[model samples]
Target chain A: MTQYAFYFNGKRCTGCKTCELACKDRYDLTPEISYRKVFEYGGGDWTKDADGFYVPDVFTYYVSVACNHCDDPACTKVCPTGAMHKDADGGLVLVDADRCIGCGYCHMACPYNAPKVDREKGHTVKCDGCAERVAAGQKPICVEACPLRALDFGTKEEMEQAHGDSQVADIAPLPQKEYTHPNLYVDPCKHAQMANEATGKVANILEVM
Target chain B: MDGMLTAFDEITLVLFTTLAPAGALAYVLVALPLIVSGDRLLEEARRRLDRFLCVPVVVAMIGLVASATHLGNPANALYVITGFGRSPLSNEVVCGSVFLSAAGIFWLTSFSEGPGRIGVRGVVVAIISVLGLVFVGVISLAYDASTILTWNTPYTPLTTWLNALSGGPLLAILTMRLARFYTAGHKLGRALVALAALALVASVIVYGLWGSLLPELRNSLASAAELAPLFMPSIGLFALLGIAALVLGFKAATWHGEAPLWLPITSTVLMLVAIFLMRFQFYMIHMTVGVGV
Candidate 1:
């Protein structure tokens, strides 16, 4: 009956995969199957007073990600079989293999690439936030293993109380398309400039049908 | 012995590359549904109960069989029913059931007709058309491979859906004309045909410019060789097919014209080919998350 939340702090994150390795090891997972990933961006608009030309022009920041467990999960909506389900009280998304037809619809619909396909089993597996471990009064393997103290887990109010005041929160914006509203939020970063430059480059490449 | 290994090498590479192209088979998922419920749409006997007979039970049955290939495990396919709670695939199952139910009602009503049957016919057909198209949208999104950028966007769903709306009516009108059922009266048919054609043209243009074209290249599909294999003659053939459908459609609606079979069928077939090829080449040209590596 407890509410749960996941938080990512960009400033303290050092682009380390320690948390990822810990989570994967705990799950006995193979490579690229990490329930969590730390995404790093190197270059941006440089400041005139900046130190080195060879360094990332503007800023160097890292963002760690896991499932948001949204109240309205798109993964559940696109699931073709009854395999994917959500725990109502805590907003946890879980997949039941017994009912999974292995259609891969949930894997396609997810914006953050949260789900990893188990090609061998013909199904998907993602961060369950170590729900079983959490239930036993132990933190998720990933959160417990983070050396940077960059991750947090607790009640929704507790998360807000713990890191809510930090300068680095966008109420948790996750990377998503304009079409659907995703539950995750991004702490506003200079990603817009980089995205704009990327867009401008693609614009000149005339599309041919 | 080396030659045999070389042959084996070629086959393995080909199959691996084609694993994604094999996804192209999803198109049939949209077509067979119409064949299952198409006959009733053209006839205008008009009743939800009677339209079930339109799909041609064999055609609908084919949809079931064709769908199984896409599944990794045939026996576990039954589990698709449980996922409807969280999945569009489930919605498709439900929508298709409603469509089939409407079709069944139409079939059962044929044995006895009264004022109630007349009233029920139109409502059922309209609803089933909506439901059938909904299933197409669901299936379009269900295919998971992200490398196929053409199929990644909503464009796949929109085009997949219009495939039925545009093609089914064409088939129904053709069959009705052959049956000599007066055929949606004449003016109505022209209006429908013209409307459908206009939609097709607009959709093709959008698809050409927005979705199919490789964003990396200046001219991907629009190149002379890709767009037309027979030089300028290909354009002429495309125009001929298009204009033939439009002119013949209007003629059929006006005075006496050929039965509806040839014109719309040809139009639908050509449009389907163009879209499918566009999809195929789109697959050839697309670049996904990490191509060079």
Candidate 2:
């Protein structure tokens, strides 16, 4: 399958949340539910290398996140009926409403905390990667709306080629493990130091399903 | 102290939270009618209707009692109806109340002028009584969660429905057996008793084995692991008792030509004890979302 990746540049990101707004608008979300979320954090260490010019060492970055559309989706394994599925090209997990019994199994199973139940619809909502738009030679809504071009979507190789491998860090944190090894890549600056207790090591970005 | 009274342990809390209404439906509406039917020993429709109505009416009132034991705020419960269209909880509140009222009115009608025993009003009321029980099964499915892979799966809702069928009917049969004393014209009681026992066996085996099997059990992120072993009976013991009930039930059916009623009555009593045990385990086995700790 032609796995895709969401390439992000932490250095360039201003944390404006344009990608978040774009994704929410694209999904037609109700209030209190968002498909993409931007998290902001500040880091500084007053490195000894620089002179006494008082360079603020605080580093802040915006992490824009949606479903990685993994190679091994935890959500599908737990669905009693085959309501959740992966698209053939990049394997974006999709929910089939016809078979869904409104059981809420998928919502509980996704470790990324990706799925949400639409109480009004009596089913669930999730990220589909804007598959319909991608198929029609249009960029994902979030990707198109990124004023800084921080959110880039394309074939994994095409994305890696354009942005280089240094961008995405590695490994999505899971409660247990995603047998469906997801396609999403994260390039965390401290990726080498972060350890997910469940996986017992740093997140492995290079794992392909 | 209210603390001890209200301080239900997690599994006990979950069980009472659910079973008070659930058990009330059995004790008040379903089993109660059967009990009244046994006491009156009425074959005629009118008397049966009057007796049957007693249960649903009583069950509706007992719902209040059981709900009090739940220990959630009474005021917040008013919003319980807000989720009506989608939530089984809402449906249960609606159906249970409506059925109770109708059952009460049916019982209140004396039928001095009617030719038939129960007549159309009796039949309609009885059918409604049974239908209300069916919706109770739906309301049982309303324990929604995002991640508790085993119980949130489709199998969970199906098993809930089965538990109601098996557990409720078994209680009814036992109540009738205790009341009827194997009197003449107790064939209907015998058949119902046997049916309830059989359904309990089928459902318990299917649910415990295939429904909540080891794969799902292992995958569960739940608080249940700590509590399940404290309450759940050994699988081997439950199985032996189940098999014994089936064998004794069939033998009595075959040898006596008529169910001695006592034989089934005894079996139903055993079944209730066993089904209640399973209910305890059911609460203990459930996985709360993201609450694996």
Candidate 3:
């Protein structure tokens, strides 16, 4: 019953987007599709302190994300053809390309927007935690391609041991983790930001593209 | 949220979301009255039902075909039931298919020259009609997912269920006219028209109450204020047409063929049009929570 997870160091990530490109290249994804995305998360305000001096409460950072391969995957729950499913070995969420009706139900159900309908391929596609590469004893292309070495992946306990506890991680502009229990662990930037803060606002529209 | 909607989001799904329920409703409404008729009228009712029942079946078939078109591969759709236990969608498809098949078989039996067991046919059609209604209910609840907060509201299920009640009779009235059976002003006619009007009014009330909660929910990702304009107009239209259609249908019933054929026809068409407009806008408003935003 071992589960794999992702560890993101938001403090070091510079939003370089190399992970996005490397993922597209690895999967041969078209211009419209990218398995990995780097979000530029930032928000702030200048406020007057009790000392009558202006204080800045602003911060910006990058969050690299892909499929969380959630413990309770919503996409698999809604799939009509049993197309979207969880991999037996790593509990990695995977789609059966042959079984998918291209109904896009998984796309709608996923809170993380993990699944995308490939119009040309006539099926849904998503990150499968690089199952092939992982089985072959290689890291996912995104982790290997990170310049700052900000991304890490391994079993949940291993990642927690290497990085810190992920229970408190909050990457703003992304959804609250409670919805999906996503297997993603983020080490927040220096500025403290709580999960569910700025709930509906995405701080990084331009950088995502 | 992205202001622009893609082609698939706009039109491809309109046919399934709109026509499928309309067809299902028509079938249920048309069959229910026949199933409940007295033995004296049972023969005539069977003749009428057999002749006109195919209209709703064809409508449902067209909708089913449109749904298949949305699939990535229609050839693999026959296996939809394979995920029956895990997916509400599979259950919905299975329900819809069963209703269609049952209705089709009943309609074929109507072609017989003799009565062919009126009691049996009546019981069968009654059960099938109820199943069709349940099928519509299933479709409504199928969209209740945590990810799409806008769709998870009680309004989604209420609107679909009410539409079947409010729109079914109108389609049935038009269908009756097409079959050339004069039913205007009969007890069943008035009862059904009254049912439609009351249901339409109820649907409007529910929509208004549901809409008023949107502002508070806006912060919670449960708001769909962007869809208000498109949806609001349809509610008004359904109410107005619901009244007009009932009045015309009742008037024609009392006139005993003196009224022009167009009276009920025009009213039903307007109601159907309003329902379609609502459904088209319904699919256009699909919003999801999380990363894609």
Q: lDDT winner among the candidates?
A: 3
Flag clash pairs in model 3.
A101-B72, B184-B253, B185-B253
- Model 1 C-alpha lDDT per residue in residues B1-293, reported as the tens digit of each score: 01122123223222212221111122222223333544445434333324334433233434544444444444566676776645556655655555556555655665665544433444554555455555555555543334333345655555454444434344444443444434334755665576557755755554555433333322111222332223233334434554555565555445465554565446445544433333333333332221000
Best prediction by TM-score: 3
Model 1, position A99: C-alpha lDDT score: 66
lDDT of 3 by residue, A82-175 (tens): 8898888898999888888898888877767779888788899899889899999888999999999999888888888988655523456556
Deviation in angstroms for A105 in model 3?
Answer: 0.7
User: Tens-digit lDDT track for model 3 on B1-293?
Assistant: 42135224536556665667767888877776577663546456558765798887777778777777777777778779897756888888888889889888878877877767777877888888888887888888888888775677888888887777776776776676666555534766677678778887887798777656544433222345553445566567767766776677666544565457787667666666666666665664556656552
lDDT of 1 at B65: 48
Compared with the true structure, model 2 gives a TM-score of: 0.49
Candidate ranking under lDDT, highest first, comes to 3, 2, 1
Cα lDDT, model 2, residue A193: 24
Which candidate, 1 or 2, would have the higher TM-score against the true structure?
Answer: 1
- Candidate 1 local lDDT, residue B95: 52
In candidate 2 chain B, what residue range of length 10 has the lowest lDDT sum? Answer: B1-10
Decoy 3 TM-score against native: 0.91
Per-residue C-alpha lDDT of model 2 across residues B167-198, encoded as one tens digit per residue: 44444444343333343555544564466566
Where is model 1 more than 4 Å wrong at Cα?
A30-32, A45-56, A80-82, A117-119, A161-164, A167-173, A176-209, B1-89, B101-162, B173-195, B205-267, B277-293
Instruction: List model 2 lDDT by residue over A81-190, tens digit each.
Output: 55667777676778776555444545545655577667567566777888899899988898889888777788888877887654443332323323335555555544
Error of 1 at B267 (Å): 4.7
